[model samples]
Target chain A: MFMFNSLVENNLKIISKLKKSLARPDLGAITGTILVFLFFILVARDTGMFSLEGTMNWGIVSSQFIIIAVGACLLMIAGEFDLSVGSMIGFAGIVIAVTSVVWGWPIWLSIIIAFILSMLLGALIGFIVIKTNLPSFIVSLAFLYILRGLTIFGSIHSTQKTIIGGINEVSKGDWLAPLFGGKIFTGLFTWFAEQGWIDVFEFGTRAGQPIVDGIPMMIVWAVVLVIFAHFLLNYTRFGNWIFASGGDAKAARYVGVPVDKIKILMFVFTAFCATVFATCQVIEFGSASADRGVLKEFEAIISVVIGGALLTGGYGSVIGATFGAIIFGVVQQGLFFIGVESSLFRVFLGIILLLSVIFNAHIRKIIIGKG
Target chain B: METPIMQLTDIGKHFCSIKALSNVSIKIIQGECHCLLGDNGAGKSTFIKIMSGVHQPTSGQIYFSGEMTTIESPRSAIDSGIATVYQDLAMIPLMSVMRNFWLGRELVKNIGPFKIMDTKKCNAILMQEMEKMGISLHDPSQSVGTLSGGEKQSVAIARAVYFGAKVLILDEPTSALGVYQTEKVLKTIAKVREKGIAVVFISHNVNHALEVGDKFTVLCRGKTLGTAVRGKIDYAQLQYMMSGEKLN
Candidate 1:
C-alpha cells in the first residue's frame, strides 16, 4: 500500500510539473484545439459517418487556411490586423493568371512577378496604415472592399471570363504543382482488405501523388513561413522590437524601439502571406476569380482570436494561431461529413467562433489577471 | 564631499495654462542618495520627468558633470548616462526576467544585419548582477510577473546600472512594497550608491526617504520649499515643508 501510494504521488508530481511547464500564453489555444479535434472525431463516429478519405480531404482544404492563419496570427500578435488578406489572395491569383496566360510569360517569371506585386502591395498598405494613424481594422477593411472591386472589374474586363485547364500542360511540366500538392496515399482500404477489426481505420501509405500534390503544398509554405516568423519574433532584435511596439507603442517609443518600422513590417508581411496563399489556390484550381477568397478576412481574424491572442495587442503565438486554423478546418469538414445542413454548419461555426472569443477572453483574464 | 555629478539650475516647466515646475534647483553628488519629498501634485513628478527627459524644461538648463545641456527626450537622457526607474518600472510582465532586464538595450552579438540577442551571455550576466546585488533569485529564466514588487524594482535598477547609468533616478521604488520588501529595495539602492552612482529617490514616505537619503529636497505646489543635508533636517521638518507648511 505504501509503495502504491508513493507511485501515485510520483505520478501526481510529474503531472504537476508538466502543467507548470505548459502554462504558456499559447498553451490554452493549442490544448483547446486538440480537445475540439478529439470531440470532432467522436461526433463523426457517433454519427456513423467517419472515414479516412474524408479526413484526408479535410486536411487538403485546411492547408491553405493554416498558412494564411499563421500570417494573420503574426500580425495579430504584433497588435494589428490585415483585412485585405482575402482580397490580396484574389489579386495575386489574377496577377499570376494575367502574366502567365495573357502576357505569354514563363511560369517562373509570372510567379516572380506575382510575388513582387504582392510584396509591393503589402508595403503600400503598411505605409498607409503607419502614416495615417488609423486603426488597422478600418484601413484593411477599406482595402478589402477596394481590392475586391478592382479584382472583379479586372477579371470582367479581361479577354476571358475563366482561364480553364491546368498550367502544367502548357509548360514543360513544371515541378511547382508537385511541390504544392504531392500526395502520399494509395487506394481505399475496405473491410476485406484490412483482414479484421472492422477496418476501422486505414492509414495513408502512399509516398507522393499529383493533383494538389496530395499533401497540399500550402502546408509546406505555412510551415516555412511559421518558422521564419518564429525566428523573427523570438531571435531577432527587430522581432523583439515588434513585440515591444505592439505591447505598448508609447512605452516602446520611450524605450527607443522603432515603432513605425515594426508596424510597417507587420502590415507588409500580412499581405505577402495572403499573396502566397492565393498563389497556392490559383495553382491548385488552375483558375482565378474575383470571388476566390471571399470572407477570408473574417476567417483569419477568427483564427487569431480562437488561437488565444489578445486583441488589445502585446500577446500571441504563431503556433497557437495554426492550431486555431486546424480547429476551424475540422469543424468545417466534420459538419459536412456529419450530413448537417450547410446553414446549420454556419450556425455551428458561429457558435464555435463565439465560444472561442469567450474562451480567449476568459483565458486572457486568467493569464493577465483582469488587465 | 565629492563634487555633484548632476546639477539643476533654476529648472522650470509649464503645461500651456499651468506651471508644473517653477525655478526648482537641486544638486546630486556622486555616491549620495538625494531624496525628493512632496505631497501629491507638488511638482515632484514634473521635476523628475524633466530630469529624466520625459519633458523638456520650459526655462533654465541642466549641468551634468559641469556641462550645460538640454535633454530633448528620454532617449537623450539615457544616452547622457541618466536612467529613470519609473513607478511602473516600464517592464513587460509576460517576458522573462533576463529579457526585461535587457529590453531596448539588449546585448547583441552583432550590431546589425546578423545581430542577435546574446541569450547565454545575458542570462549569465543577469545572474551575476542579481547575485552581486545580494538578491536571491531562484531562476533568471522565471517571468518577471512571478517576482515580488521589490524584486522587479531591483531588476529595473540593476538593468540601468548595468547599462552604465551614472545618475540613477528611482521614482518611488518602495512605494508598493511591504516592510521587508521595502528593506530589500533600500539595500539594493545602497548597493547602487556603492558603485559610485548618484541616485535621485522620489517618494511620498518621509521615513523611507530618510533611511537612505544623503540629502533631502522638499517641494510644494511646483516650488522648492528648501534643501537640506541629511543631518541638518528631521522627518517632521521635511514633512512640514512637503505639506506647504512653514517650519518653525
Candidate 2:
C-alpha cells in the first residue's frame, strides 16, 4: 500500500510539472498545430496520398508562409497589424527582378537593394503610425494598396509589361541559386531548389541536404526567427515593454516603457519578414509579378490566429504561428490530394478560423474561472 | 513628531471645467500606513493620480521627504521611490508571475549585441521576495490570470517592495476581495509598513482603514475633511467626517 501510494505521488508530481510547462499561451497553439498535422496525415492516408515525397513538397512550399507567420505573430503580440505584407512581397520580388534583368545588376546587389527598400518601406509605415497614433490596420491597408499600385505601375513603366519572367531560368544558371536550391544525393529526394546547399564543418557537413539529410534552409530560417522571437518575448527588456504596451498602453506609459518605439519596431519587422519571404519565393519560382504574393497577408494573419495569438494584443508565440502556418500548408496540400475543390478549401479555412475564435473564448473562460 | 516622508500641500487639479481635486493637503510619514477615506466622486482617484504623477496639479507643490518638488510624470514618481498599485493592478493576466513582478524592470544579461532576460535570476528573486513576505506561491511560472484576487494584490505589493518603493500608494487593494482575502491584503499592507515603506491606503471601508492605518485623512466633495492621528479619533469620528457630518 505504501509503495502504491508512493507511485501515485510520483505520477501526480510528473503531471503537475507537465501542467506548469504547458501553461504557456503558446502551448495551446502548438498542441492545436500537432492535431492539425495529425488530421492531415489521416486524410492523406485515407486518400492513398501519404508519402515522404508529398511531405517534402508541402514543407518546401510552406516554408515561406512559416517564415512570414513568425513576424506576423510578433506584430500581433505588439498589438498591431501590418496589412501590406502581401504587397510588400510583390514589391520586393519586383525590385529583385528589375535590378537583375533591367539594370543588369548582380544577383547579390539586387538582393541587397531589394532588402533595403523593403525595410525602408516598413520603417516609413511604422513612422507614420507612431506619429499620428492611427490604427495600424488602416495605415497598413492603405500602404498595401499604395505598394500594390506601385508594383503594377513599376512593371508597366520598366518592362512595359506586368509579368516578369526569366527569374526561374536565371535562378537555374546562377551559382548562388544552386547553393540555395540544389539537389542532394542525385535523386534520392528532390530538395527545395533554394535549400539544398552544403555547409562545411570540422566533422562533416553541419547543414545537410534540404530534403534527405535534414531540415530545409527555409525551415532553418523559420526556426531561427522563432528562437529569436521567443527570446525577445520571454527574456528581453524590449519584449516586456512590447507586452506592457499591448496589454495596456496607459499602464506601459505609466511604467516608462517607450511604447511608441516598440510599436514602430514591430511594424518594420513585419515588412522585413515579408521581404525575406519574397526573396525565397523569387528564388524558388524564378519569376516576379504584381500578383506574386496575392492575399498573403490573409494567410499570415490566419496562421497567427490559428497559432493561438490574441488579436487584441499583448499575447502571441512565434513557434505557435509557425506551426499554424504549417497547419495551413498541410490543409492546403492535403485537400488537393483528397480531390477537394480549391473553393472548398477556402470554406474549410473559414470554418477553422471561426472555430479557433470559439476555442480562444472557451480557453479564456476557463483561465478566468480558474484564476 | 518628525517630518513626513511625503507631503502634499494645497494640491489642486482641474479637468477642463470640473474641479476634481481642490486644495487637497496630506502627509505620509515613513513606516506609517496613511488612510485616505472618501466616497465615490470625492476625488480619491484624482488625488492619488496627482500623488503618483499621473496628472500635474493645477496649482500647488508636492514635497517628497520634505523638499518641494515637481512630479511631471509617472517616471518621475517612480524615480522618487513612489509606486502606485491601483485596483486593477496594471498586470498582464497571461504573463507569468515572475514576468509580472519584473514587467518594466526586467533583469537582463548581455550577450554580445543581444540582451537576454535572466529568467533564473528573476525566478530566484521572485521566490525569495514572496517567501520573505510569508506568501507561498505554488508556481512562479503560472500565469497571473490563474491567481486568486488576494494573491494578485500580494504580487503587486511584493513587486513594488522589490523595486525599492519608499512610498506605496494602494487604491482599494481589498475592495474586490472576500472577508478572508481582505484580511490577507491588510496583512500585506502591514508587511509593507514593516519594511519601513510609507503606505497610502485609499478606501471607503473605514474598518479596514482603521485596522492598518496610523494616520487618517477624509475627503468629501473634492475637499479635505480633516487629517487626524489614528489613536486620536475613533471609528465614529472617521465615519462622521467621511459622510459630510461636521465634527464639533
Candidate 3:
C-alpha cells in the first residue's frame, strides 16, 4: 500500500510538470515540427521524398536556413535585429570572388579577408547604433541597401559583370576550402550501396557511385552550431548577460553588466555567420552572384519568430529555431514532391507564421499571468 | 563612536540650468539602516545614484572609511563592495532564479580550457541563501517573473549579501509591494542589518522607513531638511518633513 501510494504521488507530480511545461516558449516550434513532418510524410511519402538522396536534398536546404537562423536567434535574444544579413551574404561572397579571382589572390587569403571585412562592417553598425541611440532595425536597414549596392557596383566594376566565376577551380585544392564545401562519410555510403541499400548510378560515365554520397559539411555545420549555441546560452555566464542586456539594459548596467559590449559582440557574430553562409554558397555554385541571398534576412527572422522568440527580445532557444528551419526546408521541398505550386511555399509560411505568433502570444500570457 | 562607512558631503548635481540636487549631506553607518526619505521629485533617486556611483556629483566630496575617494562608474562601486538594487531589480524575468542570482558574477566551473556555469553549486547556494532570508523556493530553475514583487526584492537583497556587499543600497524596495509583501521585505532588511552590513534605504514611504531605519535623512528639492536618529524622531515628524516639499 505504501508503494502504491508513492507511485500515485509520482504520477501526480508528472502531470503537474507536464502542465507547466506547456507554457514553455519552445512549445510552438516543437508542435510545428511535428505537424510539418506529419503533413509531408502523408502527402509526399510515395514521391521518394523520404529516400536517402531526397532527404539529403531537403536537409541541405534546411542547413542553409539554419546557418543564418542561429546567428539571428542569438542577436534577437540580445534585443537587436540585423536586417543586413541577406545583403551581408551577397556582399561577403562578392568580396571573396573578387579578391580571389579578379585580384588574383589565394583562396585561403581571400576567405580570411572577406570574413574580417564583413565583421568590421558589422562592428561599425553596432557602434553606430549604440553611439547614435538609433534603433538597430533602422541602422541595419540602411546597411542592407548600402551593402547590396556595394556588392553590385563592385562586382560590375571589377569583373565587368554581376556574376563572378572560377572560384570552384581556384578553391579546389585549398586547405580551408574543404571545411566549407565537401561531404563526409562517402566510404560509408559506398558500402551501403554495395549492400544494395542505397541507390547507385548504373549507367553514368563512372558507375557504382551512391546517389547520396555523404552528409554535406553544411548540415554538419548546422548541427554543430545548434549544439554549441544551445550550450552557450544555457550553461554559460555570457548567456545570462545576453538575456539581461536585452531584458533591461538600464537595470543590467546598474548591476555592473557590460550591456554595450554584449550587444556589439552579437552583431559581429551575426556578420560572421553571414560570411560563412556566403563562402559555402560560392564554393558550391562555382560562382558568386550579386543578387544571391536576397530576402534571406526576412526568412531567418520568420524562423526565429516561429521558434517562439519575442520580437521585443530576450526569450528564445536555438533548438527551437533549428526546428523552424527544418519545417521551412521540408515544406519547400515537400510541396514540389507532391506536385504543388512552389508559390504556395510563401503562402504556407505566412499562414504558419501568423498561427505561430498567436500561439506564442497565448503561451506568453500564461507565463506572465501565473505559471 | 565609529567612523561612518560612507560619507557624502554637500553633494550637488545639475543639468545645465536645472539642478537635480543642490546640497545633500549624509553619513551611512555600519550595521544600521539609513533611510533617505523624500516625496516625488525630492531628489531621492539622484542621491541614490550619487551614492551608488551611477552619477558623479557635480560638487561634493565622498569619503569612504575616512579616506577621500571618487566613484566614477558602477563597476568601481561594486569593486569597492557597494551594490545597488534599483527599483526595477536588475533581473531578467525570463531567466531562471539561479541565473538571475548570479547575473554579473556567475560561479563557473572549469572544464579543460573552457568555463561554464556550475549548475549544481549555484542551485544549492541560491536555495540556501534565499531560505536564510525566509523565502524557500521550490526549485532554483523557476523563472523569476513568477515570483511576487516582495520575493524579488528579497532575492536582490540576498544576492547582494552573498557577494560580500559591505554597503547595500536599496531604492524604493517596498513602494510597489502589498502590506504582507512589504512586511516580508522589512523583515529581510532587518535581517540584513543584523549581519553588520550598512543599508541605504531610499524610499518615499514614511511608515516603511520608520519601521526599519535607525537614521532618517529627509530631502526636499535636492537639499536635506535634516538628519535624525530613530529615538529622536517620530512618524508624523518625518512625514511633515516630506509633505512640504511637494512639487506641482
Candidate 4:
C-alpha cells in the first residue's frame, strides 16, 4: 500500500511538471512543425525534396516568408496588425528600381531612400491609428491600396511601363549589390565538387559553372533577422513592453509602460522588414514588378499564427514564427514534388491557421487550469 | 494633527446636463485606511476618479499636503506618487509576475545600442516585495493569470507601494473574492497601513470597511452622509449610515 502511494505521488509530480512546461506558448508551434516534417518525410522520402538542391530551393522561399513573419509576430505581440506588408514590398521594390534604374541614382542610395520612406509611412500609419483610435486592421487595409496604387503608378511614371527591368544591370559593378543579392561561398562549393565530396551534375557544367552553388543572400538575411528578433523579444526590455501592451494596454499603461511608443516602433519595424524582403528580391530577380509579393501579408500572418502567436495579442515567439515559415515552405514545395497542385497550398494554410488557434487555446486553458 | 496627504474641498462634477457628483469632500491622511462607502452609482466612482486625476472637478479645489494643487491628468497624479488600483487591478493577466510588476518601469542593462532587461534583479525584487506583503510566491516566472483573485490584488497593492506611492487608492478590491480570499486581502491592507502610506479603500461591504478602516465616510446620492471613527461607531450604526438612513 505504501509503495502504491509513492508511485501515485511520483506520477502526479510528473504530470504536473509536464503541464507546467506545456504552458509555454511556443510548444504548440514546435510540436506541430515536428509532426508536419515527419509526415512529409514518410510520404515523400523518394522525392527530390530530400536532395540538397531541392532543400535549398525551399529554404530560399521560406527565407522570404520568415523575414516578414518575424515582423508580423512582433507586431502581433504588441497587439496590432499590418496588412499592408505585402504592398510595402511591391512599393519598396518599385521605389528602388525607379530610383536606381530609371533615375540614374546609385543603387545603395536608392535602397536607403526607399527604407526611409517605408519607415515614414509606418510612423504615419501608427500615428493615425493611435490618435484617431482606429483599429489597425482598418488602417493598414487602407494603406494596402494606397501603397499598391502608388507602386504601379510610380513604375509607370518612371519606366513608362508596369515592370521595371535592368535592376541587375544597374547593380552591376556597384559595391553594395552583391551583399544583398548575390550567392556566397561559391569557391568552397567549387572546391568540394573538385574534391569529389558532392556529385556533379550528369549534364556536365554549363559554361564551367559549378554544380553546387553557394548560399543565397536572402537566406543569410533571414537567419540573421530571426536570431536578432528572438533576442529582442526574449531578452530585452522592449520585449516585455510588447507582451504587456498586447496582454492588456490599460494595465500596462497603469504600470507606466510607453504603450503607444512600443506599438509605433513595432509598426516601423514591420515596414522595415518588408522593405528588406523587397530589396533582396529586386536585386536577385534582376527586375521589379508592381504585383510582386502579392498576398504575402496574409502568408506572413498565417505563419505567425501557426507559430503560436495569439491574434488577441501579448503572447508569441519569433522562433515559433520561423518554424511556421519552415512548415509553409516545406508544404508548398513538397506538394509540388508530390505532384499535387500548388493552389491547394492556400487550403493547407487556412486549415493550419484554424487548427493552430484551436491548439493554442487548448494549451492555454490547460496551463491556466480554467475555462 | 498631521496634514492630510490629499484633501478635496466641496468637489462637484457635471457630465453634460447630469450632475454626477455634488458637494462631496474627503480628507485622507498618512498611515490610515479611510474607507469610502457607498452603493453602486453613489458618486464613489466619480470621487475616486477625481482623486486619481481622471476627471477635473467643475467646482472645487484640491489640496495636497496643504498646497493648493490641481491634478490635471492621470499622469500628473501618478507622478505625484498617487497610485490607483481599480477594481480590475490594472494587471496583465497573461504576463509573468516579474514582467507585470515591472511593466512600465522595467530595469535594463545597456549593451551598446541595445537595452536588455535585467531579469535576475527584477525577479529578486518582485519576490522580496511580494513576500513583504505576506504573500509567498513559489515562482515569480508564473503567469499572473494562474494566481488567485485575492493574490492578484495583493500583487497590485504591492506594486503600487513599490513605486513610491504616498496615497494608494483601491476600488472594491475584495468584492469578487471568496471568504478566505477576502480575509487575506483585509490582512494585506493592514500590512500596507503599517508602512505609513495613506489608503483610500472603496467598498460596499460595511463589515470589510469596519475591519481595516481607521475612519469611514459614507456617501449617498453624490453627497457625504457622515464620517465616523472606528471605535466611536458601532456595526449597526455604520450599516445604517451606508443604507442612507439617519441615526435619529
Using TM-score as the measure, which candidate wins? 3
Off by over 4 Å in 1: A1-19, A36-56, A98-114, A127-132, A157-216, A369-371, B108-118, B178-180, B245-248
Judged by lDDT against the true structure, how good is candidate 1?
0.77
Interface RMSD of each: 2.5, 2.0, 1.7, 1.6
Model 3 chain B TM at: 0.96
Residue B100 in model 2: lDDT: 80
**Candidates sorted by TM-score, best first:** 3, 4, 2, 1
Q: Give the Cα RMSD of candidate 1.
A: 5.8
| Pairs of colliding residues, candidate 3 | none
| CAPRI classification of candidate 2 | medium
| lDDT tens digits, residue span A1-371, model 4 | 99999999999889867878887777777887788789878988898677778888889988999999999999999999999999999999999999998989999898999999999999888888889989999999999999999899888887789889999888988888787898888888778877877657767456345555789999998999999999988888878888988888887776677899999999999999999999999999999899988999999998998888889899888998999998988889888888898889889888889999998887667645573
* Candidate 1 residue-wise lDDT, A1-371, digit = tens: 99999999999778646644554556766887788778877777765434444655667556667778877877777778888988888888887777677767776677778778877877777788888988988888898988888887776677446343445443346555445433333232332334542334234563222112233466678778878887777777777777677776776676678788878778778877887787777776777776788889888888777777778777777777777777777777777777777677668668777877776666555443332
In candidate 1, position B98 carries an lDDT of 78
* Candidate 2, superposed: residue stretches over 4 Å from native: A1-53, A103-109, A127-134, A166-217, B110-114, B245-247
Worst 10 residues of 2 chain A by lDDT: A193-202
Tens-place lDDT digits, model 4, residues B3-86: 999998889999998898888888889999999998888899999999998899999889998899999878789999899998
- For each model, chain A TM-score? 0.81, 0.82, 0.94, 0.94
lDDT of 3 by residue, A30-66 (tens): 8888988999889889999998888998999999999
What candidate 4 gets wrong by more than 4 Å, as runs, is A1-12, A199-209, B111-113, B245-248
* lDDT measured at residue A61 in model 2 versus the true structure, 0 to 100: 60
Q: List the residue pairs that clash in candidate 2.
A: A167-A286, A168-A286, A180-A194, A181-A193, A181-A194, A235-B117
Please give the lDDT score at residue A251 for candidate 1.
Answer: 61
lDDT (Cα atoms) of all candidates against the true structure: 0.77, 0.81, 0.88, 0.88
Error of 1 at A227 (Å): 1.9
